[model samples]
Target: MTAPSPTPSIDTLERRFSDFATLGEALDFAATGKRGLNFHDMRGNLARSYPFSEMRSDALEMAYRLIAHGIQPTDRIALVAETGPDFAALFFGCIYAGAWPVPLPLPTSFGGKESYIDQLKVQLQSSDPKILFFPEELSEMAGEAAAQCSVEGIGWTSFADRIALKCELPVQHTDATCYLQYSSGSTRFPHGVAVTHKALLNNLSAHAHGMQLEATDRCVSWLPWYHDMGLVGCFLSVVANQVSTDYMKTEDFARRPLAWLDMISRADGSVISYSPTFGYDICARRISSQTHVSERFQLGHWRLAGNGADMIRPDVMQGFVDAFGEAGFNARAFLPSYGLAEATLAVSIMPPGEGIRVELVEESELTGMPGAPDRPKRYRAIVNCGKAVKDMTIEVRDENGAILPDRAIGKVWCTGPSLMEGYFRDPEATAACMKDGWLDTGDMGYLSDGYIYVVGRAKDMIIINGKNHWPQDIEWAVEQLPGFKSGDIAAFAITNGGEETPAVLVQCRTSDEDERTKLREQIRDKVRSVTGMNCVVELVPPRTLPRTSSGKLSRTKARNLYLSGEIQPYAVAA
Candidate 1:
């Protein structure tokens, strides 16, 4: 028995685009060749490689077994998406069985068991899946959550063991529902984004043409498959193009982020990968502590280092480039893009090789309010996310629904073939966002020269006295302090005595009363100087702030907890 090769080339197949009516067809075509997936361990060692041909056979058999188990066409089956051969085969099996696969997230290390169980139950209730498949380690918790939703839960081994008889598989159509994507509950509760096979294929095809993907392109990823960026961009896109990919579990990457780069560096082929801003931040921090990163990792071959899934931070991108540039990394490799689950994945991607463009706008002008007074005397660097992808239209509209001119911040909306059919079984929620034919993105941004620059979320914008203030601006100001880090503070507007005031919550690590008081004063002063207003500053212990399933700071949740008194502030003695 031989260990899997670190750099395995699977270019025996030709690159195909826009040829498949559904993902099942894409997989069927990919299986005809030898290209497939490789799984890597935590220490950057390959554990297994499952060719698409073998995977298709396993899935086909499993599809018949699912039919024997009484699953019908369009039936929903939830699968805890873990990066392994089991999940890979099961995901394809559900497709072949003509059933919709609802991908759920695994338990995060930061959240305790109760949090994960609650999240799971909420999603299960929303999707109402017929059965849930989970890894053996999480079977107990998955069972508890499934029971709460009145669904059946079984471990992967048990699922395999129950395949007693074979039956004919169902046929899937291009217009049929493909899967349910539950949005990461960052600003609010998670909603299931219903996508169709046509929408999925359209988005994937746009990705191929937009990126100019080639046969030799290799994808290395540790993004959780439950996320749209991971599922569509990394997993499905690679399979559709017959490109080889190396994957490490999201949990493994959290522990050893360098392993992700190790796979890329060890690859003697061109590498394409994407991650949020935090991923780059964590990796840069980890490598800063390492004295020999240059001797160990090679990044010159990293052709497309994509940034998405959240707000792209230019500072973080620069830090990563600086940290790894010595090892043959190029700053131009940074590909900043904009997307959401509602669009089925990417809507706009930076042109190939033109990385991280910034447009400096006057801070006060970002609010787009007429005759607005308070000028912050600062400029905000809004990163250009790039032009809309093929066949996608982006428009910036004012609150009155009128299209705004370029450089005027307004609600971001898009209409495209890749847009979701609607939210699953929630007509009210779907109607609220879908108007006419365009999908209201609920995000605030502006367009300049046909390029989109996202400023902030409309739901999270803090409006005080008719002037718009972004919580990110306030949080970023406080983070300028030497001891502060990203996501260490939360800022929002609070109602006080018939007027709205700014409230800032900071996570302090010090217990010394004087030091705590000094920190609070420093944060207060910084915010005041930036916004020209006095603010309420509360000092809470570190780790008290809340994060989304995808690890983004949840300002709405933070405000709720603070207002509800769930977060107790440190006592400041005079």
Candidate 2:
């Protein structure tokens, strides 16, 4: 288990960012005066490099041409491309032109054209984007989707063609919305998180400073650009700090885990990067298959391996450190972080150079029932996502919006400059989320000694017989038992119509009859032991558990299936 580092004083954080005006200015200054930004496509066999200055100039030119082609400042445009230099150019182009850029994830060609078109239609209907800008390679896919949707216009722009256009537009004020990040919306409808130039600047400045990022650092990442962690954490942060970055295709990394390690090793990337639980598990599995040892990558120099965009698992971190300890990776490089698209990218980051800090308590005590005293237990770890970034304030509050003290688990609320102005044009939703200048994060967690510990989503909390229990607690416990994949467990509550009692649904993998019976018994026993609630354990085949594109388990969809009788519950042994 990694011990906590010395917490830096708030005064230290405040003093560090006293000079920067905004995130855009900080990035512009870095690009022009300090770190000359450079990017490489690690997956490309040709090995082409795109400099930051050239990318910025290309973005400005593209934005100017788009405007010249009748696209207005307030027009919303959709970008459909994989993670690459083209995606970055279109994103920054929108920012320069004061347009909203909605980044859509690239569809799987294997899913067939119909499935792809359906998803694109749903996004277009929801966002009502004025135009769809796509890569020429995806022109066929884009054309099919555009035909199905009611979008006003559709255009294909090649990277070479966009850069070839001539334009000189002066950078404007820092108040315009720079990016429109769509939230994961796991539980409800997705909202566009409007991040302004000023907000982006503030978040990047705070994050870079907190991580001790330098111009000499390089990043190798497989996180997708449509997501906040990939866009801001990997790409924007690299550009803002003026560092070189190498990006690999997310699908390619998924198919070949060792490709991630190979890229980091080849790039000598000092700033190793990722969302929580990804890098650790990949390295653990990949290192096991290696026959020849290579000394090119020094994992120790891979400082600031960030964990965010989801709950940080202790076992994952431990597994990573144990696997790479021989390869010169420092366990202290594991940095658990907290952020959302609502607050740009990062709200709080654990100070770099310090190892991850975690807390252990009886599972029942965390769900509002009295169980045991707070002891420093190292075995069962829940990571601390350190202190709030500079200019941000975090408060844990109850259902009635009353703030709770440290150790009391509740909804995490944040107030900061990096927070979005509001969900675009959705006043009712915005009003519901923003209260007293604090954004209701919808995540459930607690603060102890100023460090935040997340349990689960507030909406995902399961209540049985008047006691509250986080689904993650039950899911984690079940997954730890034999015969379960690392991310295969999902626990949700099913409420029958006209009945108050909501039954629990536990999703796990089992095919053997005896093993399935034993797994069922183990799941029920764990739930009863932890929450004193009897749950219906459903044994499903492998990959039955639904996941978002980024691979986070989808509890809502699983619960819906259980309620609709699409999933059958396993019988307990006599």
Best by lDDT: 1
Instruction: Report the lDDT tens digits of candidate 1 across residue range 260-374.
Output: 8888998757889888887888889887555677798899989999988666768888989888988898889888888888999889999989998998877557644333356
Where is model 1 more than 4 Å wrong at Cα? 6-10, 164-166, 186-188, 368-376, 461-574
| Model 1 lDDT on a 0 to 1 scale | 0.83
Per-model TM-score on C-alpha atoms: 0.82, 0.74
Q: What is the lDDT of residue 16 in candidate 2?
A: 30
Compared with the true structure, what per-residue lDDT tens digits does model 2 show for residues 1-574?
4531211111111123313444445444444532333333444221445666667777777777677666677678888857766777777777666677888767653435654666576666667787787777777877777766867445555433643455554455677777677753221245677777788878877887777765346677777777788878877776665566666777676676666666665554366576546556665766654533345345667777888876676776787777777767788888889888888888888988777787886555544433335644223356899889888999999888899998988999999888898887678888988887889988889999888888766677564421235676667556666766456777776534422232445555555678767767777776565445566666665566677788888787776666546666665556
RMSD per candidate (Å) reads: 9.3, 11.1
CA lDDT of every candidate:
0.83, 0.67
- Ten-residue segment with the worst summed lDDT in candidate 1? 367-376
